[model samples]
Target: MIRRSILFCLMIVFAVSLCACHKENPDPSGQNPDSSPTPTTPDTVTIAPVISGGGINLVAKLIYTVDASTAKVVRSTVMVRDDTDITPALVIDCIVESLKDESLNLSFDGIEYSDGVCVVDFDDSIFTIAGKSADLEDAILDCIAQSVLDNVDGCMKIIYRIHNEAYSTVNRHFAYDFVYMDD
Candidate 1:
C-alpha cells in the first residue's frame, strides 16, 4: 500500500512538471507559443517505375528540373536485373522514365547519348495524343535536354529523332548545350 502511494505521487509530480513546461514561453514579437517546423514541398520529384531495375545500385538514373538560372537534379532509384543489357536506349529510357512529372508532360520511345549528342526518338503519333502545340514541343524538348545535360557527361546537344533522322533544337529558347571545358 505504501509503495503504491509513493508511485502515484511521483506520477502526479511528473505530470505537473510536464504541464508546466508547456506554459506560454512566447517570443517578444507575439507569435504563437506552440511553434513547430513548417512543411515545404519539393520542386522536383522522381517516381519509381513499375519495371524496377533489380540491381545493386539504388540510384540508376537522374532527371532534371530546369529554369533560366540553374538545373536541379532529381535522382531515381531503379534496380536493374543483374544480367540486363545497359544499352544506350536503355540508359536514356531510364532517364526519361524518371522525369515524368507535372512540369513536363510527354513521353518517348527511345533515347541515346554519345560524344556530346543526345538523341531522343519518339513515335510520330505523340502529336496525335498530346496535340500539335509548339509550346508542348518546346517544353518537352527543354525538359529532355535539361535532364540529359545534367546527367550525361559530354552531352552538349540534343537531337529529336522523329523520322529516323537526327533533328537539332531549332527554336533555341533555352540554353541546352552545357558540355564545354577549358582544358
Candidate 2:
C-alpha cells in the first residue's frame, strides 16, 4: 500500500511538471499564449530635397547627367540667373542649343543642385573621339564653359568630366591648354 501511494505521488509530480513545461512553451508556431502583441520601436528616417536651391541669382546650383549612349543632355536644372529678368526654362533651352552647336557628341541627362557645386556628366564619346584641329577642341570646351556661365549666375568655372573621369584641359591636337580667357 505504501509502494502504491509513493507511485501515485510520483505520477502526480510528473503530470504537474509536464503541465508547467507545456505552459512555458505553448506554441512553436510563433503565437503568444498571453495574446499580447510585441511592442515595436519607431524608426528614424532621413529626407533629401528633390531640387536643391539657393545660390547666386542666374546660377542655379545644378547637377547634370549626360546620356552615355546618345551624348545628349538627359536632364538639367532650371537656370539660375543673376537677373530674375530671364526665366529658367529659356536659359536651359539656350544652354542646350549652345551645347548642341559645339558638337561635343553628348547630351545632358539631368541637373541636380546641391551644396555649392554643379556636377555635370557627359557621354563617354566626348572623350573617345579625337579632334582634328586645336581650334575645334578649344571651341568645344569654350562652348561648355560659356553655356554654363551665361545661364548660371555664380559659375565662374566649370569642372567638366566624361563618364566621371576628368579629361585633359589641354587641347590634344594642339598640345596646349585650351584658353578660355585672353589674359
Which ranges of candidate 2 are over 4 A from the true structure? Answer: 1-93, 98-105, 108-113, 128-130, 168-183
Candidate 1 has a TM-score of 0.41
Best by lDDT: 1
What TM-score would each prediction reach against the true structure?
A: 0.41, 0.36
- Once model 2 is optimally superposed onto the true structure by TM-score, how far is the C-alpha of residue 115 displaced, in angstroms? 3.9
Give the alpha carbon lDDT tens digit for every residue of 105-171 in model 1: 3456666667767666666544542354455455455555665565555656666665454433333
Model 1 lDDT at residue 126: 44
The residue-level lDDT of candidate 1 at 52 comes to 73
Residue 131 lDDT in model 2? 41
Off by over 4 Å in 1: 1-57, 60-62, 65-91, 95-110, 129-132, 166-183
